[model samples]
Target: MAEKIIIGITMGDPAGIGPEITVKALSNPAIYDRCSPVVIGDACVMEAALTIVGKENVKIHPVSNVDQCLFTPGIIDVYDMKIVDINKLEYGKVSVMAGDAAFLYVKKVIELALAGEIDGTVTNALNKEAINLAGHHFSGHTEIYAEYTGTKKYTMMLAHDNLRVVHVSTHVSLREACDRVKKGRVLEVIEIANKACLDLGIEKPKIGVAGLNPHSGENGLFGREEIDEIIPAINAAKAEGIIADGPVPPDTLFSKARGGWYDIVVAMYHDQGHIPLKVVGFIYNPMAGKWDAVSGVNITLGLPIVRASVDHGTAFDQAGLGITSELSLVNAIDYAIRLSKSERIK
Candidate 1:
């Protein structure tokens, strides 16, 4: 029998729901069947999380390196950083200690992956503001991965089941997002999107490219971005024998993608892609006054190492309550495993 893939999971900001969800997700014996999951963060934080999430039966095994991991169910091996101060830590609030710990955790996981100590990595959500306060200065995990791995051309891919969307430009202002749209960048994203689908075992993936302007610029009526940039990129993708479609109107493109018309949609920018993906993935129960499920996977395509993350944030309000959903983390581990196996095949 083949060995289970080794997946390194970064316990995100110590003050957030990261540790809570990490313990909850690891409590599932099914996950151990697929991957040797290891948490790269403070063992003390994880210990507290196990109790908070009511998984006290599960043990926290601290390992300084990958070879030390037992890789067994009911035993979550933490590659302990021991950086977070449990006494100083407060659920939901931002702190420099937590921020620096979060940054270091991510950095260590990337280092482990680059060194081939792990097959893939899954990340819990980290607070951007907190990380910056710690002086890491990274915009997000994608940027951190790109920098540490020396990947130049990469895009964020968010997936909920069969629905997937890749951004041409993410983490930029609306004005900058519009200005960032160009034939070259759009084509680059389309190419990446096509390859991403192929990686997911989609044969002859149909790529749907979205327009910057509404109604896809109404054929130059609403805006010329469609004619000037997006359409040309689609045509260029076609030239490369990629089954690329649209400059489809932003309003309707996602609906078609969700209905299985396209394998993946190439969004023009950050919110353009995030809004629709979240609309489908994030479910809130009004009567219960809590989320029923927050399920989605955020993948970084074109990275040297496989990385997938929970689509939701730290959920500061719900952190210590142990009510934040671990479904997204479960989904992320599944993706990381699949992507790692795919890499092994390659």
Candidate 2:
């Protein structure tokens, strides 16, 4: 049998659903069959999560280092950072304490990945407002990973089953996002999207680039971005022998991509990409007053280390409720393992 991939999972905001989902996802023995998983967070938080999820069979084994992890199916080996005081943390609320703890956990995991101590890292949801309140002023996980890993050129790829999308710009104002969509940046993201598909096992990725304007500028009637920037980039990409096409109309791009017409869609901005992916991944049950499933993986491309994250946020409303679904976290772990294994083979 092949050796199991060791995945480092960062416990996100203590006040959020991070702990609950982490514990629930790890309860399945099948996870251990694929990889040796370790949680990098407060031991007390994980213990509370275990209780909340009623996973009595699973024990939280606190380890000071990764080497001490047991990698057992019924046990959750945690590299306890001991950053949060469970007594001070409140469910369904944001606090600086939780934010600081979440930041520290992510920082530690990134350090471990850089040192080759972990094959790849999987992140739970962290609260952006809380993190900023704690003084770690960054946009989100993608920025944090890029900064700590010294990665200058990186893009966020959201995947749900076969429908995948990559952003040209994320976490920026719409105006700023629009301004940032130049040929250089558009072409850069297209290349990253292609490479991301390869990492996900696509031999020759067919990429569809979304236009920034209506009707792809209708040949420069509505906007000049397509003629001046987007199309130029597509031409540049084709010249480089990449199987890319578009400045496709945004209205129809996602439908085609979802139907397998393209391996990946190069969204001009964040919402253009995220909305379609989320619509498919997020499942809500109004009658039940809860989410039935939150299933998607967010992969960071053009980084030295492999990282996959849940394509959802810190559901503070559901924290400590034990009702949150772990599907997204599970998917994230699967992506981490696939990306890590692919990296090893290359």
Candidate 3:
């Protein structure tokens, strides 16, 4: 194969806007120009999406493997997972079928990546609640990729230019998230973030780890977590020559990252990191009652196989209204391609 970067794009929750966005995204001939893009999803659903979006000329190419792909414009190469009964999929409703199918799309992409069938993967948004409801029980795409790819060590890297962040605890309850801010996990994630920064072409990255408590436990005035777990973690990472600092106030560390003081920040939990990133990335339109744009890609840092995703969830409410935006999906594909390129060069 000619280092032919076969990019596998998983169509997310069919009940949501996954099909719509996948269709809309490939309307660009340039996506095919950069890489031979394939969709690990349903053909009938994509057909509906194309019709809904009114791009009747856009055609779907079903392939058994990426090697058989035609890198042609106006045509999408889809590996038919055949997991949905489109009649049963209520546009905006969560279904076990949708959840299971979403899980399969992701799972197959990993298998193909490991088997060298695809060079990289760009995942669309999947509904966590739906996945769990179907008993697939993953927190999100990061965990799913980490587990299936047999990546024992991995970190979630959220990036948009210099406003990058990695998390120590994601997908846990608030109290559990607080408890998980131990030295070992903290140090692990710090190292992961550092490596990720290097992957982003930063030679020597500066990382600021956010404290688990307010005012970094206020120097034991408010809490002792900083004294007990966080501080030790920072010491460990620094001891090994990682430019890690923090137990800094969470409120201030983000501003520092935004101001270019640090290459990235390590957040304690999912929302802690995600909130600031979305605030910077997601563009909302109140009048239209929609998010008009999203600018960040969620990269799984320690995976053996390359995976990146839209930093948004399944827009179940906007399923086939024909206004779903593929900008985020397109961004995810671009980032996946870039990461794959970086890894290939190494």
Report how far off residue 163 is in candidate 3 (Å): 1.0
Q: Model 3 off-target regions past 4 Å?
A: none
Q: List the candidate 2 regions with Cα displacement exceeding 4 Å.
A: none
Query: Least accurate stretch of 10 residues (summed lDDT) in model 3?
Result: 1-10
Predicted candidate 1 versus true structure: per-residue lDDT over 1-346, tens digit per residue: 1277899999999989999999989999999888889999999999999889999999999999999999888999999998977898998999899999999999999999999999999999899999999899999999999999999999999999888999989998899999999999999999999888888888899998998887889988999999999888899999999999988888999999989899999999999999999999999999999899899999999998999999989889888988888999999999999999899899
**What do the candidate models score in CA lDDT, each in turn?**
0.93, 0.92, 0.86
- Candidate 3's residue-wise lDDT over 152-220, tens digit each? 877888887679889887878998988888889988999989887777678999999898778988889
Query: Can you write out model 2's per-residue Cα lDDT over 204-279, one digit (the tens) per residue?
Result: 9999999999999999999999999999999999999999988899999999998989999999999999999999
lDDT of 1 at 274: 96
Error of 3 at 85 (Å): 2.4
The C-alpha TM-scores of every prediction are: 0.99, 0.98, 0.95
Better of 1 and 2 by lDDT: 1
In candidate 1, list every pair of residues with a backbone clash: none
Clashing pairs in 2: none
Tell me how many clashing residue pairs each candidate has. Answer: 0, 0, 0
**TM-score of predicted model 3?**
0.95
lDDT of the structure predicted as candidate 3: 0.86
Give me the candidate number with maximum lDDT: 1
